[model samples]
Target: MLRCPNCNTHDIGRVGTNQFYCWGCFIELTVNDGKISSIHQVEEDGSLSSLNDLFLGDGEQDSISL
Candidate 1:
Protein backbone atom coordinates (compact mmCIF):
# COMPACT_ATOMS: atom_id res chain seq x y z
CA MET A 1 0.00 0.00 0.00
CA LEU A 2 1.13 3.52 -0.70
CA ARG A 3 1.64 5.69 2.33
CA CYS A 4 2.13 9.41 2.62
CA PRO A 5 5.78 10.28 3.24
CA ASN A 6 4.68 13.48 4.91
CA CYS A 7 2.05 12.22 7.34
CA ASN A 8 3.07 8.56 7.26
CA THR A 9 -0.58 7.75 6.70
CA HIS A 10 -2.19 5.31 4.34
CA ASP A 11 -4.96 7.77 3.52
CA ILE A 12 -3.64 8.46 0.06
CA GLY A 13 -6.03 8.69 -2.87
CA ARG A 14 -5.13 8.44 -6.53
CA VAL A 15 -5.78 11.66 -8.37
CA GLY A 16 -4.29 10.61 -11.68
CA THR A 17 -2.27 7.89 -13.37
CA ASN A 18 0.74 8.39 -11.13
CA GLN A 19 -0.47 11.27 -9.01
CA PHE A 20 -1.88 10.84 -5.53
CA TYR A 21 -3.34 13.13 -2.96
CA CYS A 22 -2.72 12.67 0.74
CA TRP A 23 -5.79 13.46 2.80
CA GLY A 24 -3.78 13.22 6.00
CA CYS A 25 -1.51 16.11 5.11
CA PHE A 26 -3.25 17.70 2.12
CA ILE A 27 -0.30 17.18 -0.16
CA GLU A 28 -0.01 15.80 -3.66
CA LEU A 29 2.50 13.07 -4.53
CA THR A 30 3.81 11.98 -7.87
CA VAL A 31 5.10 8.49 -8.33
CA ASN A 32 7.50 7.18 -10.91
CA ASP A 33 8.92 3.67 -11.18
CA GLY A 34 7.27 2.81 -7.87
CA LYS A 35 9.08 5.61 -6.10
CA ILE A 36 8.02 9.05 -4.94
CA SER A 37 9.50 11.43 -7.47
CA SER A 38 7.84 14.62 -6.33
CA ILE A 39 5.63 16.12 -3.65
CA HIS A 40 3.50 19.27 -3.57
CA GLN A 41 1.22 21.13 -1.25
CA VAL A 42 -2.30 22.02 -2.32
CA GLU A 43 -2.77 25.66 -1.67
CA GLU A 44 -6.13 27.29 -1.06
CA ASP A 45 -5.95 28.85 -4.51
CA GLY A 46 -5.61 25.38 -6.01
CA SER A 47 -1.98 26.02 -6.79
CA LEU A 48 0.73 23.51 -6.07
CA SER A 49 3.87 24.36 -4.16
CA SER A 50 6.82 22.01 -4.19
CA LEU A 51 7.49 20.22 -0.95
CA ASN A 52 10.15 17.88 -2.23
CA ASP A 53 12.86 19.41 -0.12
CA LEU A 54 10.84 19.07 3.04
CA PHE A 55 10.01 15.44 2.42
CA LEU A 56 12.76 14.01 0.27
CA GLY A 57 15.56 16.41 1.23
CA ASP A 58 18.09 17.86 -1.20
CA GLY A 59 18.17 15.78 -4.38
CA GLU A 60 17.04 12.69 -2.51
CA GLN A 61 14.25 10.33 -3.45
CA ASP A 62 11.88 8.16 -1.44
CA SER A 63 10.73 4.71 -2.42
CA ILE A 64 7.09 3.67 -2.37
CA SER A 65 5.78 0.44 -3.77
CA LEU A 66 2.83 0.86 -6.09
Candidate 2:
Protein backbone atom coordinates (compact mmCIF):
# COMPACT_ATOMS: atom_id res chain seq x y z
CA MET A 1 0.00 0.00 0.00
CA LEU A 2 1.49 3.27 -1.12
CA ARG A 3 0.65 6.59 0.49
CA CYS A 4 0.23 9.72 -1.55
CA PRO A 5 2.60 12.51 -0.65
CA ASN A 6 0.26 15.31 -1.53
CA CYS A 7 -2.83 14.13 0.29
CA ASN A 8 -1.18 11.64 2.62
CA THR A 9 -3.68 9.01 1.60
CA HIS A 10 -3.02 5.38 1.00
CA ASP A 11 -4.84 5.43 -2.30
CA ILE A 12 -2.24 5.00 -4.99
CA GLY A 13 -2.48 3.10 -8.21
CA ARG A 14 0.47 1.78 -10.13
CA VAL A 15 0.55 3.30 -13.55
CA GLY A 16 4.03 2.19 -14.51
CA THR A 17 7.04 0.35 -13.25
CA ASN A 18 7.98 3.00 -10.74
CA GLN A 19 5.27 5.49 -11.38
CA PHE A 20 2.12 5.88 -9.35
CA TYR A 21 -1.05 7.90 -9.58
CA CYS A 22 -2.50 9.41 -6.40
CA TRP A 23 -6.26 9.42 -6.40
CA GLY A 24 -6.24 11.56 -3.27
CA CYS A 25 -4.82 14.64 -4.95
CA PHE A 26 -4.70 13.52 -8.57
CA ILE A 27 -0.94 13.79 -8.64
CA GLU A 28 1.52 11.54 -10.36
CA LEU A 29 4.60 10.39 -8.49
CA THR A 30 7.84 8.88 -9.67
CA VAL A 31 9.66 6.72 -7.18
CA ASN A 32 13.34 6.09 -7.22
CA ASP A 33 15.29 4.37 -4.51
CA GLY A 34 12.17 4.28 -2.36
CA LYS A 35 11.74 8.06 -2.49
CA ILE A 36 9.53 10.35 -4.49
CA SER A 37 11.84 12.10 -6.93
CA SER A 38 9.27 13.67 -9.15
CA ILE A 39 5.74 15.05 -8.91
CA HIS A 40 3.23 15.88 -11.60
CA GLN A 41 -0.41 16.78 -11.88
CA VAL A 42 -2.77 15.21 -14.36
CA GLU A 43 -4.55 17.98 -16.13
CA GLU A 44 -8.05 18.01 -17.61
CA ASP A 45 -6.59 17.52 -21.07
CA GLY A 46 -4.66 14.52 -19.80
CA SER A 47 -1.39 16.36 -19.73
CA LEU A 48 1.15 16.21 -16.97
CA SER A 49 2.46 19.27 -15.22
CA SER A 50 5.41 19.37 -12.90
CA LEU A 51 4.58 19.90 -9.27
CA ASN A 52 8.09 19.28 -8.02
CA ASP A 53 8.67 22.66 -6.45
CA LEU A 54 5.39 22.53 -4.59
CA PHE A 55 5.51 19.02 -3.14
CA LEU A 56 9.05 17.90 -3.45
CA GLY A 57 10.88 17.69 -0.16
CA ASP A 58 14.40 16.38 0.31
CA GLY A 59 13.91 13.75 -2.40
CA GLU A 60 16.65 11.51 -1.20
CA GLN A 61 15.92 12.08 2.45
CA ASP A 62 12.15 12.00 2.48
CA SER A 63 9.89 9.04 1.94
CA ILE A 64 6.57 10.03 0.42
CA SER A 65 5.06 6.62 -0.23
CA LEU A 66 5.40 2.89 0.14
Candidate 3:
Protein backbone atom coordinates (compact mmCIF):
# COMPACT_ATOMS: atom_id res chain seq x y z
CA MET A 1 0.00 0.00 0.00
CA LEU A 2 2.68 2.44 -0.88
CA ARG A 3 1.67 5.93 -1.89
CA CYS A 4 3.41 8.61 -3.90
CA PRO A 5 5.16 11.22 -1.78
CA ASN A 6 4.54 14.00 -4.26
CA CYS A 7 1.04 13.31 -5.47
CA ASN A 8 -0.07 11.36 -2.43
CA THR A 9 -1.72 8.84 -4.72
CA HIS A 10 -1.99 5.11 -4.23
CA ASP A 11 -1.13 4.60 -7.88
CA ILE A 12 2.35 3.37 -7.22
CA GLY A 13 3.99 0.46 -9.01
CA ARG A 14 7.16 -1.48 -8.17
CA VAL A 15 9.88 -0.94 -10.74
CA GLY A 16 12.49 -2.85 -8.70
CA THR A 17 13.03 -4.53 -5.38
CA ASN A 18 13.08 -1.20 -3.55
CA GLN A 19 12.22 1.18 -6.33
CA PHE A 20 8.75 2.52 -6.92
CA TYR A 21 7.19 4.68 -9.63
CA CYS A 22 4.30 7.03 -9.24
CA TRP A 23 1.95 7.13 -12.19
CA GLY A 24 0.14 10.07 -10.73
CA CYS A 25 3.02 12.49 -10.92
CA PHE A 26 5.51 10.43 -12.88
CA ILE A 27 8.13 10.50 -10.17
CA GLU A 28 10.42 7.74 -9.02
CA LEU A 29 10.86 7.19 -5.33
CA THR A 30 13.47 4.96 -3.81
CA VAL A 31 13.05 3.78 -0.29
CA ASN A 32 15.74 2.63 2.07
CA ASP A 33 15.33 1.79 5.73
CA GLY A 34 11.76 3.09 5.70
CA LYS A 35 12.79 6.52 4.46
CA ILE A 36 12.97 8.19 1.08
CA SER A 37 16.60 8.38 0.09
CA SER A 38 16.11 9.49 -3.49
CA ILE A 39 13.51 11.26 -5.58
CA HIS A 40 13.53 11.73 -9.32
CA GLN A 41 11.11 13.00 -11.91
CA VAL A 42 10.60 11.25 -15.23
CA GLU A 43 11.39 13.58 -18.03
CA GLU A 44 9.71 13.62 -21.44
CA ASP A 45 12.70 11.86 -22.94
CA GLY A 46 12.62 9.21 -20.23
CA SER A 47 15.44 10.85 -18.36
CA LEU A 48 15.50 11.34 -14.64
CA SER A 49 15.74 14.79 -13.16
CA SER A 50 16.52 14.93 -9.48
CA LEU A 51 13.73 16.58 -7.56
CA ASN A 52 15.31 15.89 -4.21
CA ASP A 53 16.47 19.44 -3.73
CA LEU A 54 12.94 20.76 -4.13
CA PHE A 55 11.24 18.29 -1.83
CA LEU A 56 14.06 17.50 0.52
CA GLY A 57 15.03 20.90 1.73
CA ASP A 58 17.12 20.97 4.90
CA GLY A 59 18.10 17.90 6.91
CA GLU A 60 14.78 16.16 7.23
CA GLN A 61 13.55 12.73 6.21
CA ASP A 62 10.28 11.89 4.52
CA SER A 63 8.69 8.49 5.02
CA ILE A 64 6.39 6.80 2.52
CA SER A 65 3.74 4.17 3.12
CA LEU A 66 4.81 0.69 2.26
Top candidate, metric TM-score: 1
For residues 1-66, what per-residue lDDT tens digits would candidate 2 score against the true structure?
577767878888999998999888899988888878898999999999998877765544356436
| Candidate 3's TM-score | 0.89
**What are the TM-scores, per candidate, against the unseen true structure?**
0.91, 0.83, 0.89
- Across residues 15-47, which tens digit of lDDT does each residue of candidate 3 receive? 998899999999998889888888999999999
- Report the candidate with higher lDDT, 1 versus 3: 1
- lDDT scores of the candidates, listed in order: 0.90, 0.82, 0.87
The best candidate in terms of lDDT: 1
User: Model 2: residues >4 Å from true position, as ranges?
Assistant: 57-61
> Residue 6 CA error for candidate 2 (Å)?
1.0
Error of 2 at 54 (Å): 0.9
TM-score leaderboard ranking: 1, 3, 2
- Clash pairs detected, candidate 3: none
Candidate 2 Cα deviation (angstroms), residue 21: 0.4
lDDT score for candidate 2 against the true structure = 0.82
lDDT per residue, candidate 1, 1-66, as tens digits? 898887899998999999999998899999999888899999999999998888888777887788
